[model samples]
Target: MWASILIASFGTYVEKLVGYLLPHHMLERESIRRMTGLLPVSMLAALVAVQTFAVDQTLAIDARLFGLGVAVVALLLRAPFLVVIIVAATSTAFVRWLGWLP
Candidate 1:
């Protein structure tokens, strides 16, 4: 077991070292940077979509959608980050408390 852990840790360390040593020119390409910049946002959006719109093995839209919309509106209005999170969470909790979802 210790051997396995040592091997795994060594492999991970090597991979990170290679990434850290890679030539900057490779990452400096305009298209690469642009796409990389969007990757995080796209991934988070996908995660949120799955959680908000899926139920068990199927798809469903419910009160979570309302909370998400409200949160988005608050973000677009440049509300403080904490305010957006709190409003979204509170709205979701209130909806659940009211038994808006079955």
Candidate 2:
């Protein structure tokens, strides 16, 4: 067990070290940087869209769609971040509880 743990720890450390010590210029060209910057928003949008529209692994509009709309409006209005999260979550939960989801 100890030997296994040591090997795993060493492997993990080496992988992390390689990641940290790799040349940034090699990994982060202009196009790569632009793509990286866009990635988070795109990923978030995909997640939100999927969650809003997915039911039992099939596509169907649901309460999460309204929640996302409210979230967007809250973001546009510069509402407090916590308030927006709370409002979105509560609104979505309420909508779900209303049995409007199908």
Candidate 3:
């Protein structure tokens, strides 16, 4: 488990290092450009979906979904990323504190 964790960390670092070391011209290839542009958003969306919906290897419907809804609304309104996070967290905490989510 420790070895796998280290390997994954090293692989992630290597991927970032390669992304940084690659030349702008190489990234200018149409397919590469499109991929590079979409990759971050795609990754973020996947991360968000997984975190918002999955808990203990099962699909969940809870305060997290409401929090993510707040985040999405903030994003759609052009709020800064920090504000989006703050709003999401605040709403989630409020709902949980109010005993509205289980």
Candidate 4:
């Protein structure tokens, strides 16, 4: 376990070092700029999908989906970030409390 941790740490350091060593021109390219800008959004979407739909090793259809739907609607309506989060959490808790989903 220690060996694995050391290896991963060293690999991460090298990866970051290589990123720093990369030419500025490469980072400035239009395609690279676009990808970097969109990467976080895509990653967050993937994370949400996984978290909302997956339970343990299986797929789940439950209150989480309703919560996500509420979040999407809130986002479309231009709700503030904190409001969106609170609304989603409240909706999820309400659903769960109704004993409609486990």
Whose lDDT is greatest here? 3
Residue 73 in candidate 2, Cα distance off native in Å: 1.9
Model 3: clashing residue pairs? none
Model 2 agreement with the true structure over 1-102: per-residue lDDT tens digits:
999999999998996796589987865689977997898999998987787788777887777788888899999999999989998988888888987753
What candidate 3 gets wrong by more than 4 Å, as runs, is 1-28
TM-score of each: 0.67, 0.65, 0.70, 0.70
Model 3, 3-100: lDDT tens per residue? Answer: 99999999999978986898868666899778878999999989989999999799999999999999989999999989999999999999999999
Off by over 4 Å in 1: 1-20
Residue 41, candidate 1: Cα error in Å is 2.9
Give lDDT: candidate 4, residue 60: 87
Q: How badly does each model clash, as a count of residue pairs?
A: 0, 0, 0, 0
Backbone clash pairs in model 2 (N, Cα, C under 3 Å; residues 3+ apart or in different chains), count: 0
User: Model 4 over residues 1-102: C-alpha lDDT tens digits?
Assistant: 999999999998996797789877967799978998899999998999999999898998999899989999999999999999999999999999998876
Q: Write the per-residue lDDT of candidate 1 for residues 1-102, one digit (tens) a residue.
A: 999999999998986796689987877799988997899899999989998899988998888887898899999999999999899988988898999863
Error of model 1, residue 55, in angstroms: 2.3
TM-score of predicted structure 3: 0.70
